[model samples]
Target chain A: MKTDEKTRAPVARIPDADVPGTVERMRKGERRAIASVITELERLSAAAPALLRSLQPHLGHALVVGFTGPPGAGKSTLVNAIIAQLRQQGRTVGVIAVDPSSPVSGGAILGDRIRMTAALDDDGVFVRSLASRGYLGGLSPAAVRIIDALDGAGYDVVLLETVGTGQNEIDVAEVADIRVVIAAPGLGDDIQAMKSGLLEIADVIVVNKADRPGAEQTLQQLVGALSIRATMSDKVPVLKTSAINGEGVPKLIETLDQLGGKVRAEDAVSRRRRRARYLIARAASDIVANRIKAGSKGGLDTLADSVLSGTMSPHAAATRLLED
Target chain B: MKTDEKTRAPVARIPDADVPGTVERMRKGERRAIASVITELERLSAAAPALLRSLQPHLGHALVVGFTGPPGAGKSTLVNAIIAQLRQQGRTVGVIAVDPSSPVSGGAILGDRIRMTAALDDDGVFVRSLASRGYLGGLSPAAVRIIDALDGAGYDVVLLETVGTGQNEIDVAEVADIRVVIAAPGLGDDIQAMKSGLLEIADVIVVNKADRPGAEQTLQQLVGALSIRATMSDKVPVLKTSAINGEGVPKLIETLDQLGGKVRAEDAVSRRRRRARYLIARAASDIVANRIKAGSKGGLDTLADSVLSGTMSPHAAATRLLED
Candidate 1:
């Protein structure tokens, strides 16, 4: 009878067969249960579906805030400082640091996580570093699932932090309710880099390390650049922070709180719907990839022939398939 | 007649209308023509398709070699040294440095490219820095198209250099005929990092910075790790190179040449077909994104609803979408 576990559907598996019991324990702030659920979901064990289903109703409780910036933007320092501010407010926090590095720096990423989160001894603060192993490398589906897991476990806030400003890193912004794009002075072309990609996604922009020499110029450039763009009618607060000194953090927290109630106040159903949309989009991409792998997709062979023969561009053929 | 330019399709646009002439010049080793054609294609200007079509018959001339590793692995120094050795053989080389950094350091990527390729003043050497502005942090469709441009322009070899080993960065492996994953001593956990991800895609692995202490140990670990991996049927040659001292590079080049002819020997048709498959797969991802944006893709809403309601896991819902 125990061997029957192998033949059963993934939703009916053992670790997750105790889904309800785990969920109950996790909600009561049992740290082990919370960690177990996240680990099983991240590894995509067979029990993930049942665990996810059980955790669904508890989703959307935590306000997911994302922090991102260029490599030298002092994001980890800012994140640690923000964690301190959050802890001071007596809010339980779960920090998920998602860095999809080249496969060569696994130890370096762990080293980074520990260094950033080392001092917090409070049980209310749980830190998990997610190495983005997704196809594109920013926030993976596992991170998405883990966010829900943290939310279900009753964390008051979930901070999603991603390293770098690559295309995939920008994607981390999509999942957060409040997206904060960080910048620092004297790191040349980062502001230009922001102008091209990160500026648009930012709900709140921070010029960290404001004590640096060119901080004022950097702030003005950002403000000027934001003014020229008419996309977001609401003013995106551009603030300066000296993360080392803890200066400007309290103001930052105040601004975040002001933005929070309005952003996170959407009804539970709508909030869940927004997440559903992002999830479905990710799923659709995976479906296309699998179909491509199978290689017998309807007209893909013919379309590839057309591309090689110069009758159609690769993109135009893909569009034709979608239309069909 | 000038007014008509506004309404015409991209294929028939001005810069691209001279596609045939441009291709003729580029094929004849005209550096300006090569640069111009590549510029137009990279920007995806109105004339890209026509330009691409014109270059079709001329593709697959150069052997594309990809160099990737973790940050501080000396990828730039190694690539530059290889370029010098390739130049010693009187072969023309085109080096494309693709770094999809977190958006903050536009200036830094440029600086690295200059430092890597600065000493080479030969007309036979063409070096371009491509900041990966792709959706993910690694290789993009633009990189694929530009590779064809370089190949058609008749560079004897194309060296593709991507910074770091993000998920997207490993993607540089896909387009290259020969994939070289580099490692170095003194990089903590980099060897461990390779075992998990970089090892699988590596055609020829190198323990770069071989002059450093622990070089032998890193090399042993790489060999041991490769032995354990069963996916790669052919023995992947592991070499050691000191980019600073120029030691072991000649053997490295010899190994690459031995692997190159066999890998690149496939007829132009199959070569084009391989490239087409990659392009089509990327297009499929884009198509899915557009469908998600349009929000009317058949039954996506229903799938999202099911996902939101916890009746189906996000991935299961995606699988169902593909089945439908």
Candidate 2:
């Protein structure tokens, strides 16, 4: 997975049989082959199911970690530091930056992803930006499939980065075996985003930009918040990291390694199964939404009318729609 | 609706017959009654369908306007200015602040909503906050129901304010008759959020905090951004508003009035129907997610096994599950 000599090659369409070949190369750690599989998934091509099927034997081999926080928390820098440390340890890392691109604040995350990817020249680290705009539900289709690609490509670790406390991010982040939430010193408003919900999902909380003033206060605040939680407090660790100077990163990586060590053979099977369930449910939701929105079906408009008139509960109407 | 003498009353449980009475009082613009209906909806009570059904005849009279932007855009302040002007024009207003509560930034929007509501002493204005956390989809059931309650209560206008660019906010915002997206001067990253997608949906773009430095540059930048968009550029009007001094608010109100005028009775009918579809779809999605997550059904595991092994696609499995 080193520097590609084919950097200047023109694109050529792969025959159906060779699509499976690309998947094989992807499994053997060829960067271009992995990228090709990802491109097919992003295109929502007919080859996706076949590719994923081809990836089945190789699934759940890598440790998947999720990192999330509000903007200005230095999430990108922190992720970079983690990548550097992982590379030094002779581990290949795959990065998926889930862009929570809502209509109002759409492209901001894209810039961060570009910058993060550009800074990493090592072939062992592959980073891709997943635009989550226009998606009506949690984690996009490409995200789940791409994770499989990276994992199947024999990467030692996969890093998922999202820069917001959004429902989309939460759904995406939950897929990871480890979830890391980061905050910078003195970004109190950023912490507020964490207090109600994000803190609940965090496995490891990092006070990024620890060189800044109030880093201790931020770290203490996170600890205090985690302590009040009934379940995750004792399990979750809070660390301080100045990503700019690489201070405190080794401990963070060590924590990650310890946490990564906890995932056993059985847990991987369950994780793969959970991902399957997510894919199926998301597909079902889309199917239901499309059928309801189209109103071209005979009975849907009547059900909607029943709902509008308050004669039927939405839950009941949905039950009928699904069961009938 | 003004000056409730019954504010100190104990929380009394309403009988089933009397629950309908509260809905009637809500339709007649009684503040306590409206609050009661909203509370019931929030509780996801058994009486919600009947309350909503009782509200059907009163739907679609009020002009619905949505305002959204990044945090720190002075959304609360601008909304307050709009409320004051709306009250001065003898228009009763209902405000629904859609809080895009993600795990990390959960309670911040709640604080903004509380402050906005506290400042409004007029009985003619009502504001409610709806949390959009822990949801896997866009918008929430309570938010949709609350809009009906306010609309049915004879408010002349309903204002929706969302604190961020999240999918939940986007869905909630789309329910408005006229969508207004706000921005402030020199928040370059904030504007980056808009440039990708929010500018396209904006019916009226307001550069709030016009008193801030570089307001003109911001205005020109937005105008240039709008110019590049083929459809919305001609229709969308970018205006500057010094929400602190109420500068440009009257014009903003005038713009709202003009835009609100274009939504005819037929459009209102279609809009209500769309809301019904959203409700049904959400309910269906919830049902699907629950069922898939439970793994309780007999055949689901088999289907999931096929998916895990890549023998079948997610969409195909969903189709078989639904259609079977």
The TM-score leader among the candidates is 2
**Candidate 1 C-alpha lDDT tens digits along B47-125:** 6667778887777778889986655567778888988898899988888877554343553645655665756457778
Model 2: per-residue lDDT, tens digit, B197-268? 556567898999899899888888778767665676789899999999999999999999898778754566
Location of the lowest summed lDDT over 10 successive residues in candidate 2 chain A: A1-10
Model 1 steric clash pairs: A102-B165, A102-B166, A164-B102, A165-B102, A165-B103, A190-B104
For each candidate, report what fraction of the true interface contacts it reproduces: 0.26, 0.41
Tens digit per residue, CA lDDT, model 1, A73-187: 6787888898888889998888887755434355464565555584645778788777765324335666777787888898888998775433345557777889898888875
lDDT of 2 by residue, A1-324 (tens): 122144321233444588778977787778788888887666545555567667777877888898876556777788888888888889899988766454434454466656656455577888887766432344665676778788888888999886443445656666788888777776434244434455656778888989999999878877876766658778989999999999999999899889888864456667876777777887887787777777564687788777665456678888998887
Relative to the unseen true structure, what is the C-alpha lDDT of residue A206 in candidate 2, on a scale of 0 to 100? 88
TM-score of 1: 0.77
lDDT score of model 2? Answer: 0.72
The deviation in Å at residue A213 for candidate 2 is 5.3
